[model samples]
Target chain A: MKREKVVVEKIVETFGLTKRYGRQTVVDRLDLTVSQGEIFGFLGPNGAGKTTTLLMLLGLTEPTSGYAQVLGLDPRRWPLEVKSSVGYLAENMGVYGDLTAYQSLAFIGDLNHINGLSQAIYEALDLVGLSEVAHKKTGQFSRGMRQRLGLAEVLIKNPKLVFLDEPTLGLDPDGIATMLELIERLPAEKGLTVVLSSHLLHLVSRVAHRVAILDRGRLMAVGPLEELAAHAGVSADLEQVYRYFFKNHSQVLSEATR
Target chain B: MKAIIRKELADHFGSTRFMLLMSLVFMISFLGVFLAGQGIREVLAGGGGYLLRDRTFLLLFTAPGAFMPLTAIMALFGPLVGLILGFDAINRERNQGTLSKILAQPVYRDEVILGKYLAGLITIGVLLTALFLILTGLGMTGVGLVPTIGELARLAIFWLMSVVYLGFWLGLAILASIAFRSVATSALAAAVVWILLGFFVPVLGQTAAAALTPLEDPARPRAEELAAYDHVSRLFSLASPPALFGEAAVIMLDPTHRGSEQALRLSTMSRLDRLLLNRFQGVLSVAQSLILAIPDLLVLIAFSLATFLGSYLVFVKQEVRSA
Candidate 1:
């Protein structure tokens, strides 16, 4: 079974990746592996180092010690190679308000050094239902519109894998539903692997094929949501299983902070 | 890098702030030319036995009446141009949360800084070149005479020197942006340093000279009695970028300004003696004036390179955390 999985080419793999700032270790010795063409949820609460881990995996930030591979290339050794094929949508990411939506997409195309991308950009914008406002300045965009534009910005390059960090952050109920629908469709429609990081359990439960529960820089559990819930003897839901895993220490930490 | 430069250029050209700055540069240059043209008209109307009445166009650079010359105005405003170009280059992007998004693309992190700095330099070059061309055109129409080859060569050198001088402020502002996370804080910091270098240092240098080397007899101060004051003041003034740029630009654009240091030597020169010196030096080769200004150019280059190096060191080692 392990040999078959190796033959299929795991999209992400890490062996004890760690990051430290001064004396505080944000991401401890973490061993993680994510397979290809599946929506993998990296579930954690605030201050759980999800963003830092994603940054390291994307080669935006260097890890203090450990190994990491994204799409068969070590991100530390081949950052540009990994980044060229990986689309990252950061939490609360901003659009260039000065530019029209079309111009912003064109600018990203230029930055990526892609040639003859007008058709691809238009398709991506239409995919996100932003074609109507393609010529409008992004400064006037609502949060939902901007969020969709950010997704379009990522999708325009036709990345092999897409990492969405808190994709529904600061969105209204309607916007959240739209974003979740888009996230659900990303892997199925685009033949792309996804690493969706979020704090909301029910949202991750809705779309992610597999989930990893992280607390205070340490992995508490990993596997399919049903399997983790069954193993922990809890109801087959993300929130219950997550609570079962972090029940030992999160209470103490929350109380101490309070 | 090309993409970054193109975007930056678009941003600058489209920005109302840049339009206002360009308008200011245009208005000042035209006013300087108009005022200097009136003086040249006076010389033509038998005002005085002025030297180079036929070459009255040179006065537009050397002695614009009741105002600093066009080159001086540029030297004064050049830092503002540079500071505005880069005061928020890094911080604004970081604040907008676009820095990480852009860095996550295929481009290396260094490319962002390199592209932005090059954009500022290119903008400075274009803006100044346009102003210089306009000034040249105005001088031709106002004075009704085209500049000589030597004058054009001098103007070209002055243009290059102004770019280098402004580059110092540009680099410093970018460096400030990199160090500070807030755009407003970075802008205020850049403006503070700009004021210190552009205005305060020169003023402080004169005050220091007056206090340290007070002439015992204010009635008739000897050249030797004031030598200490001149030397001290020049030393302090050279520490400021504008002083270095202004001194070099004046030397190149106005060939008649022998050297600021030659004052002590020429203090004993009578009116006729000065006239004779001007007549002899009016025919001085371009190479001579260029050689005289080389030291100031070197100093300006050094300042620019140092600030660029500082920015590079801070930016390369800086970490992009989860903002």
Candidate 2:
């Protein structure tokens, strides 16, 4: 009997990925995969190696062991290729303080080598609801406006994959809502695959189709929200499920110590 | 890469820093022209008798002094501008959380470095050229004198020398910026290095040499003392920028005053003898000057290349993060 070939749909894959700073390991051995056209959220608290993992995926920082591949290209070896297919926005992303919103967008659009750059910039600005402030210097922009501008940069390239490390990090409630809506629409509207890492588990659950929870440089759990909730013996609420995992792990450590 | 370079140039020109530097250059150029005019008038009118006597050495040395303030700015800020261009080249993007965004683009890392470097080089080149034009205009107008073909050649050499000098400082700044993550820290490091190279190194070298070889009293064994003094003087001269620059200026300005005793003695002979001696001295001085310039140019280029390569490697290895 002949066996059928198994096909993998994942656009990003990491195997035993680790990063260390001197004696302390920031991101321990980890395995992860993000399927094509999916919104994958990475959830963790502060100092849980969320940013380090993202950097390694982007090939901005080298991993201590193992490797990551995006679009079937090794991140460390073919970063430019991986990068070209992906758009990314890290926490607290800054724009050139001196440039106006329009100027900054045009400049970034040019760098991305996009066709009809000026039109793309205008469209990005409009998508972010920043058209009114397009002429204002970025230094004068509010935190939400700057975040929107950063999102515009990610959107201008029309990349297949996007890495957003805290897309709404410093935004207000309304700004957060706007950002979440944008994040939710990307996959369906643009055929984009997104990997978003954030400490806000509830926000991640609301916007993402699948979520990976990391704690202390290790993956605590990863799956669809409902699946993780079911496994953790919680109801439909992902927030409660995430809390249960952390509480359960802490209780086990405490019990062992006693 | 061209986009990045264009953006950088736009940012640099839009900055207040460039405006302030331009203002400083203009002020210095005007002052230099005024001084040169006053001196030239005195010499041409022959009103101040014996003013030119024993003053050729002083004149050659003092010409550099007129431009010292401008040269000092080049030595000090060339590195500063380079550091500013590079320090945040990657880190700011990371801090703004845009590094991943940029890296995700099609541009290569080497392209980013090259683009930024080219932007910086262009800015420095434009500034230097503007200053040179200003000086040239003033030299011609204020003194009412056009440089001879030889003088024009010497000025071209001086302009080339300035680029090498500025490159040394700019390269150091780039290295400092790459080595330090914080812009403030990088700027401080570059400033410290500039201080050492510009102000302290020559002074320290001279002090060390003087301490090693002491001068004897003029009263005892004049000839022997002279011999020992000459030997020590050669070593001391090596420590002096004024000495090196003076030798260069003489060959450039006169081209007929090579340091040979026979040539000097011939100048005091008949007019025909003096003319022949001047021609011989010009040829000899040109050769000697070229020999001296080789070491200076080599040191400048070597230091610049070392600094530039060090900065490039450090930047390549740097960890990107949003902080």
Cα shift from native, residue B244, model 2 (Å): 7.7
Which residue pairs show backbone clashes in model 1? none
Candidate 2: the clashing residue pairs are A83-B104, A93-B96, A93-B97, A94-B96
lDDT of 1 by residue, A74-125 (tens): 9988998998899999987988998999999998888787777898789989
True lDDT of residue B121, candidate 1:
90
lDDT of 2 by residue, B1-323 (tens): 99889987897788787788667656765565456555666676885454433233223213443444333334444444444444555444555555555555677766776676677777767876777777766666765556555455555565566565555565666676557766678778877775665557656655654565555653553444344444454454444333333344444334444433233345347788777755754333434555546564565667667777787788777776646
lDDT for B49 (candidate 1)? 56
Candidate 2 structure quality by residue, lDDT tens digits, A97-213:
888998888877888778998788889888889988889999998888888888888888888898998888878999999899988888998899999999987798898988887
Clash numbers, per candidate:
0, 4
